[model samples]
Target chain A: MNKNEIDNANKYLSKFARLTRNVLDEKELISLSQEKTLLDDYLQMEQLRFGFKYEINHSEDLDLENIEIPSMLLQPFVENAVKHGISKKATDGKINITFIKKANDLALTVTDNGNGFDTEKKNNGLGLLLSESRVALLNSIYKENRFTLAIQSATNGTKVSLTLSDWL
Target chain B: MRAILIDDEISNLENLRTLLEKHCPKVTIMATAQSVSAAVDAIEKYLPDLVFLDIQMGEQTGFDVLKLLPRRNFEVIFVTAYDQYGIQAVKFAALDYLLKPIDIEELINAVNKAEYKLATQIQTSQLDFLLQQLKKTDTHVSTIAIQMQSETRYVTLSEIIRCEADNTYTYFFLANSEKILVSKSLKEYADLLRPNGFLRTHQSHLVNPKYVKSWLKEDGGILLLTSGEKIPVSKPNKETVKQALQRQ
Candidate 1:
C-alpha cells in the first residue's frame, strides 16, 4: 500500500481498536469465549466490505471461569484474514469462528474460504506478525505449550487455530 | 468545612480559591496541590473534609488521584473543564462536585450543603450508600426520580420505552407518550436496567422486556416495539434479546 493508503488503513484499525476497548470497558461481566467472539464479530463487521459472513458458534457450558484476556487480541487476526485472505477474492466469502473446550485447553478456530497464500513464508505482514506476538504473550501467561497458534492455507481457503490454557 | 484545591492551572486554582473564600467562608482552604504527588501528599497530610478537584491536570484525572489514595476520607467536588456528560455523571453519583470557571453562587450552595450535611453528622454509611447507588446507576437497574411540573413520578424499569442521551441529560421515553429528562447517561440507565429485563438493543436506545413486539433481521437487526417504533438492535445484544425472549 502507498503512504496515503497505509495511513488510511492504520486509522481504520485504530478506530476498531478504540471501539473494542469501549465495548469491553462498558461490559461488566464478560466470559472468555464471549469476549473473544465480541472482538471477532466487531472486526468482521468494521473491517470487511463485501459479502462476508461471520458466524460464532459455541456450545453451552464453555469454560469461562474468571478468565479475562487483553482487550483486542482477535481484531488484528480477523482484520488480517479479511484484508489479505478475503479482499483479494472476487467471489463471496465466509469466516466461521468456533470455540470449543477440550481436555485442558480452550480451542478457537477461524476458517475462511477465500484466496489462500503460502503459510511457510515469513512474510505474513505486520498484522499477522502482531497476531503471532500476541499469541506468544498469551503463552507467557499460560505455560509453554499452553498456548498454540497454527496457520494453514490450502488452494481455496485458510484456517487458523489457537489454543489457550484452560483456566476453568 | 475544610477543603483542598488541586489543579495545575494557576488561574483556575486562584479563581476557585477566591470563590470558595468569598462565598463559602465556612470552608477553610487547608492547602493547594498542583501535581499528582503533591496532591496525594497533601491529602494524606492535611486530610481535608472536601477537595475541589480538577479532573485534568497535565495527564492524570481526578479519578487517578482517587485510585492512588488508599481510602478516600474526604468528599470530592470534581472541577472539570467542559465535559458536561461527566458533570452529569457526577450528579448521578450524588457526590458533590463542581464544574470549572466555578460559579460563585453554585460553589457557595454546594459547600453550604456539604457543611450542613456534615454538621448534621449525616451517617457516612448513608452517604456511602448513596455513592454506591450512584455508581451502580451507571451499570445497574435504577429507579430514576422524575419531576414533571407539579406532579412527580418514577417510571420503573419495566415501563421504559427508550433513553436518548443528549449531552448532560438523558431523555427517558415511557410507555405513555411522556418523556422525562434525567441527569444521567444511556450507559448508566442501561447498567441500571440490564438485570431488570431491559436490554440495550441500540447504542442510543434501551428497551423494556414488555415492549419488543418482534425482531427484524435485515442487513443488521432491528426491533419493532409495541408502540410500532423501530429501534436498531446492536449486534452485541442480539443474543441478549434471544435469551430474554426465551425466559419470557
Candidate 2:
C-alpha cells in the first residue's frame, strides 16, 4: 500500500481497538462524550471501509459533557444510514448528526442523504428493531426521563431522532 | 388456499415447501418456479391465492415477475435474505415479508395475514401501491395509509395540518377541517411524517410546516396554523420551529 493508505490502515486499527474496548465495557449507561467518541470511531471505520465516499456533518451546542444516555443508543441509526442509505448512492452521500438541548430534553438526530427505508414497515432492519427494544428497556429502567425515537424516511433520505425528556 | 413459491435457489424453495407442509397445512403448494419467466408462467397457470417471492434471482428480480403480470389477483409475501433495497421497496409499498432462515413465528404470522387478506378478498391496494412505487425513480410517496378501527384511510401528506397525541392515540388535523383520531401512538406518526415536512414542536404535537401560519412568542411559545388553530411549542423546540418556519 502507499504511504497515505498505510496511515489510514493504522488509524483504522486504532479506532477499531477503541470500539472493541467500549463495546466490552459492560456499562448500561455511558456519558455523552463516551457515546460521541464511540460514534466517531465507528463512523471513521465505516468511512475507511468505503474509501471515504461519504461525508459527515454535525450541528450541535457544546453542552454534552454532563448528560448520560443508554449505551450505544446512536450507533444503530448511524449504521443503518450507512448500510441502507449511503451505500446505494452513486455520489455525495452525506450523514448529518445533530445534538441540541431543548428545554428539559436533549434532542439527537442522524440524517443521511441515501435511499430511505419505509418508516411505516414493522419488519425493517434488525439494527432498528434491536434499538427500539433497547429504548423500551431503558424506559422501564429510567422511569422519569423517557427516551423517544422518531424516524422519517423518504426516497431522498432518512432521519432518525431521539428525545431524552427531562434529561437536561 | 393455493400458493406458488418462487426462488432461484432450489434449496430455499424446498425448505419453504417443507415448512409450509409441516406448519401451514391449509396452504397447498400449487406451483414452484426458479426464474422470472417460470414464476410468471406458474402464476398464470395455477392462479394461486398467494405467492411467496424471493427478491433477488440472478439477473432478474421478483419485481420483474410481478411486472409481467396483468394485474394482482392474489396476495404476495416476499421472502429474502436481508436484501436492503428489495426489503425497503417491499416495505415502502407496505407488503408482508419474511427474512431468510425465517422465524416460524414470523412465517406463521405472514401466512395468517395472507390468509386473512385472501378470506376478506380485500382490494389489493397495497400491491397496487407497491407497483406504483416501483415505477417511480424517486423514493417519496404522496400519501400515507392510516389503519383505523373499521378501515384504512389513505391521507394525502400535503393536506395534513397537525397531529396531536392522546396517550396511546393520535389525532390528525387536516387542512379541510377534518380531524382523524387514530389508535396508534403519536410518536409513530411523528417518525413517519418527519421527512415529509412535519415538525414535532412539543411532546404531544407534530405540525406540517406548510400549514403553519405563524410562530407566536406568547405563552412561552405557540404556533398558529392556517386553520386558525394554535399549537403550543415547548422551549426546546422553539429554535427548531423557527428554523423550519424560516425555511418555509
Candidate 3:
C-alpha cells in the first residue's frame, strides 16, 4: 500500500458522498449506510476478480460531525482501486483503508499493493476532477477548515492520504 | 359511469364538464387533473371507468401519463385539435377520439360507444396493443375528422387551415374555403392533433400547416389563414405556432 492509492481513495470517497447527498435525504443516507456490509461483499467479489485481498478499518468513535463530509465519499475510490488499479496486476495484491481522528483533524488513508503510476505527469480524469471540485466546495462551506491530499507511489504499490479539519 | 376530465386549460375543462353533464347524465366526473402529477394521482385514486384525456400538457404528453398507470382499466377518449395523421392512427387502432369544440352529438355518440363497450365487456386490449405498436413504429398521424352538416367528413392531411371552438362544436376551416363542424371540445382536438401537424394557436384555434397566410403581431397577435380569416392567437401558444409555421 502506498500514499497515492490512499489519497485517490479518499478523494473518490469525498466526491461520492457529496453526490449521494444531493440525491438522497438524511433518512435515505442512514439506510444506505446500513447497506455497507452489502458494499463490502461486492468489494470482496471484486477483490477476488483482481486476485487481491480487501480490508477496511474504522475507528469505533470516529466523529462524523467533525468532518462534515458528503455521503459515501470513500467507497468509489476503494472500488476503483480494486477494479482498475489492482485487477490489472500480475500477482495477488492487497488494498487496506484506514480511518482515524488525529487531534482536530480527520485523516483517511487508502493503500493498495498493486501497479503504481507517475502521479506528477498523469492528468486526473473526470472522476478525479469531480473529487477535487467537491472537496473545494466542502472547503468553502467550512471556511476555517483546510482539506489536504497527498498521493505517493513506488514501484511496489500506491498510498493516498487525505486530512480535513475537525470543524468540517 | 365514472369519468375523469384532464386538461390544463380551465375553459376546456369547463366546456367538457358542461357537455358531459348535458349529454351523458349517467357519467359522474369523479375527478379532474390539471397536470401530469395530479392526473396520475387522480387516475390512481378514482380509477374511473372513462377518462377524457388531453394529449399535450406542457412538457409531458398524455402518453407519458398513461405509461405511469398500473394498467389500462379506464377507457381514454382523446380530445385534441385537428390533425389528419393522428385521426388516421385513431381510426386504424379503432380507438374513440374526438376533435375540439366538442359537438353535443359527437359527445353523446362517444359516450354511448363507451357505455356499450363497457356493458358488453368489449376488450380494449387490441387497441392498447395497437397504440403500443404505433408508438414503437413512430407512426404519428396529423389529420382530424370534420362534421359537415349531419355527415362526418375528414379533411385531407394537408388541406386543413385551422379549427376554432364555438361553444360545444368545433369549426374546421380548410384550404378550399370550406368550413366544417365537429362535435368535440378544443382540448380533445388539441390532444389528438398535437402529435400531428396541427398546433393549438389559441384556446379556440388549432391551426394547420398548409393554410397559415401571415402572422399579425399587434394586439396579442393574430394568424391570417389562407382563407383570409383572422384568428386570434393566444399568448400561451404563440411560440408553438411560430415554430410550426417555421417548419412549414
Compared with the true structure, all predictions reach lDDT values of 0.65, 0.77, 0.65
**DockQ scores for all the models shown?**
0.02, 0.03, 0.01
- Candidate 1's DockQ: 0.02
Give the CAPRI class of candidate 3: incorrect
Q: Candidate 1 chain A vs. true chain A: TM-score? A: 0.71
In order, the candidates keep a fraction of the true contacts of 0.00, 0.00, 0.00
Please report the candidate that would top lDDT against the real structure. 2
Give the better candidate number (1 or 2) by TM-score.
2
Q: Number of clashing pairs, model 3?
A: 45
lDDT of 2 by residue, A1-168 (tens): 366563355456556765775677565556566678778878877775563354333335433432446678888898898889887663577788777778667888999888787888888978888999988987776665678999999989898999888655
Q: Which candidate's TM-score is highest?
A: 2
C-alpha lDDT of residue A9 in model 1: 51
DockQ (C-alpha) of model 3?
A: 0.01
Model 2 reproduces what portion of true contacts?
Answer: 0.00
Q: Candidate 3's C-alpha lDDT?
A: 0.65
Better of 2 and 3 by DockQ: 2
Per-residue alpha-carbon lDDT of model 2 for B117-143, expressed as tens digits? 777766757766677777888877687
